[model samples]
Target: MDLTLHVWRQKGPQDKGKLETYPAKNVSPDMSFLEMLDEVNDGLIKSGKDPIAFDHDCREGICGMCSQVINGRPHGKQEKTTVCQLHMRQYNDGDEIFIEPWRAKAFPIQKDLIVDRSSLDVIMQAGGYTSCHTGGVDDANAMLIPKPTADYAMDAAECIGCGACIAACPNSSAMLFTSAKVAQLAALPQGKPEARKRVLAMTQAILDEGFGNCTNHYECEAACPKGISVKFIAKLNREYLKTMIPTSTDA
Candidate 1:
């Protein structure tokens, strides 16, 4: 297949970027999107042209590093699939695809398709942890948790921090990502002690990092690769309130 690519190119963080055109030809329908990008880079290298830069690692779709806005959709409009998992067959031969980095204040463009997503790292550092001191592993049956709660926590924990939620929202909200990280830890008994501090710190960190607030937009859930629900925001909100409320003993 032959395709036209309008890819964003920037020299550095301080440099402005523009869409530069390149012809992608003979692309196999089975080739993953990143693989097609690899072919394009190989062609550029052989021709003494600067190659396009994009984030990708563990092309198996586990890493969530392949963050790109393809044809105006994060991860190329495939429901629940990452950019690394999208195949060439999704597009027609004469298609003109536009690729760009995630657009958000917190995610500044490094160059080309790469952005400084370390803000997400900062959010993770804010919470999303179990600080129990266990020198040895405990039996799975040692704690009795309702199966439904465990399942819900596991689902939220599936988030990979790819920033699709922010890209999909009109105001570029990071609530979905932050909520998921909070829920993952706030579900279990080991997490109960820190639940109050966790949500407080994480939400404040998100605001401090310049991410926009959620205005009841469902786009974050729609674009989420893990299909993490916006209800996690509600969960986080409830947890946030707990921080201000007195504990049972004090009450």
Candidate 2:
């Protein structure tokens, strides 16, 4: 299959970028989207031109590093699929694919398809942890958590911090990603002690990093590669409200 790629190219964060066209000839339908880009890069190298730059690691889609907006959709149009997991076969021959870095104030473009997603790291650092001093691992059976709660926690923990939620949102909100991180721990007894502080700190960090607020657009949940639900965002809102409500001082 042959395709026309309009890829965003920028030398550095300060450099103004544009969508440069390149021909992807004889692209294999079986090739992963990154592999197709690899082939295009190889051709550029041979031609003494700069190759396209994109972030990718652990091509198995576990890393969530392959961040790209393909044809107006983050990680392409495939539901619940990351860019690394997307295959070239999804496109037809002679398709004109527009590839760009995630568009968000919080995720400034580094070069080509790479963006400074360290804002997410900053948010993670702000909270998303419990400082429990349990020295050794405890037996799984020791904790009497309901099975449903454990399952929900596991589901929330599947978030890979891909930042797709922000890219997909009209307001460029990080609420879904932040909420998932909070929910992963907040659902469990282990995360209860720090729950109040965790949600407050993380949500504040998101704002400090210049991320937009969630307006219930639902785009974040729709674009999440891990299928993390927006219900986590609601949970976060409730948790945040806990901190805002005044407590009784008199006994």
Candidate 3:
């Protein structure tokens, strides 16, 4: 199939960017979206033009590094699918595709289709871990957790920190991503020790990084490649509240 790609190009973070069109001729339906971009880059290199810069690590969709906004939708409107796994078969011949990077105040563009997503790492570092040892692997296995609780923790853990949630939000909120990190640990027994502190620290870090607050638009849930639920946001709220109210043990 042949197509026209209007891709955003910027020389650097300070450079003003614009959509530059190129013809993607005779593209294969089996080609992954990144593969198609590779083909386009190959053509540009042969013509002595600079290639488009995009983020992509594992093309298998596990890494969540392929960050692109296709035709105004994060990850091209495919439910629970990342751009690296998106295929050309989703498009038709002579289609006009608009490609851009994650657009959020916190995710400033570094260049063409690449944004500095280290803000997410900062939030994670604030508290998204269990510093307390949970003993060895076998010891952890010996602790019998309720099946439902384990499933809930695993569901929240599915988040890949792709920042698609932020890109899709009207307020550019990081709540979904942050809540996933909080809820994953909050639901686990090992995570209970730091639950209160984790929620408070991570939420503060999110605000410090200039991420907006969640107003329940649910766009983040829709854009998540892993289908991470907004229910975790509710869990985060409960966790935060617990931190504010003194418990009997504290008394």
Candidate 4:
């Protein structure tokens, strides 16, 4: 199948970018999206043209490195699928694909389809962890957590931090991502010791990074490749508020 990819090319963060058209001929239906890109890059290299720069590692969709906006959607329109997991069978013979790097101030363009996502790392560094000393793996019965709570913790822990939630939001909010981090720990018994501190530190860090507040558009949930629900944001808000309110134990 033939495909025409309109890809954005930029020299640097400060450089202006424009869409460049390239023809992808005979794309196999079984070929993954990154494999299609490899074919395109091979064609470019043979023609003495610069290849498209995009991130990819562990192309099995386990890693969130395959970051690109495809046809007005992050990771294409496939539900719960990353770009690397996207296959050409989803498109037709003459389909025109528009590809671009993630557009956000915090994730400035590095070159072509590559963007710096280190701002997320900075936010995580600000306190997305529980510093308590967890002893070596104890027997399962030792920590005795309710099954429902453990399930919720794992549900929230599914977040891969792909930034799709941020890109899909009209407000460019990181609430879903932040909330996922909050909930994964908040629901766990081990994390209860620093629950309030974890909530406070992460909330402030995300705000300081200049991400917009959640406005309930729910685009974040729709765009998440992991299907992490926007309900996590609600959990975050409640948890953040709990941090401010005086509890008998915290007080």
Cα lDDT computed for each candidate against the true fold:
0.90, 0.93, 0.94, 0.88
Q: Candidate 4 — which residues are off by over 4 angstroms?
A: 134-136, 248-251
**Residues 1-251 of candidate 4: C-alpha lDDT, one tens digit per residue:** 99999999998878898999999999999999999999999999999999999999999887899898999999997989999999989999999999988887778889999988887887778767877557887677988888899888888988888899888888877889988988888888887778788888887877788788788999889999999987778888888888878889755
Ten residues in a row with the worst lDDT in model 3?
132-141
List clash counts for every candidate, in order: 0, 0, 0, 0
TM-score for candidate 1, please give it. Answer: 0.96
In model 1, the runs with Cα more than 4 Å from the true position are 248-251
Tens digit of per-residue lDDT, candidate 1, span 150-243: 9988998899999999988899878999999888788878888888889988898988998999899798898887788988889988888888
Sort by lDDT, top down from the best: 3, 2, 1, 4
**The CA-based lDDT of model 4 is what?**
0.88
Better of 1 and 4 by lDDT: 1
Off by over 4 Å in 3: 134-138, 248-251
Q: Number of clashing pairs, model 2?
A: 0
TM-score of candidate 3 against the unseen true structure: 0.97
- List, residue by residue over 1-251, the lDDT tens digit for candidate 3: 99999999999999999999999998999999999999999999999999999999989988989899999989886789999899999999999999999998899999999999999999999999998546655655678899999999999999999999999999999999999999999999889999988999999998999999899999999889999999999999999999988878788
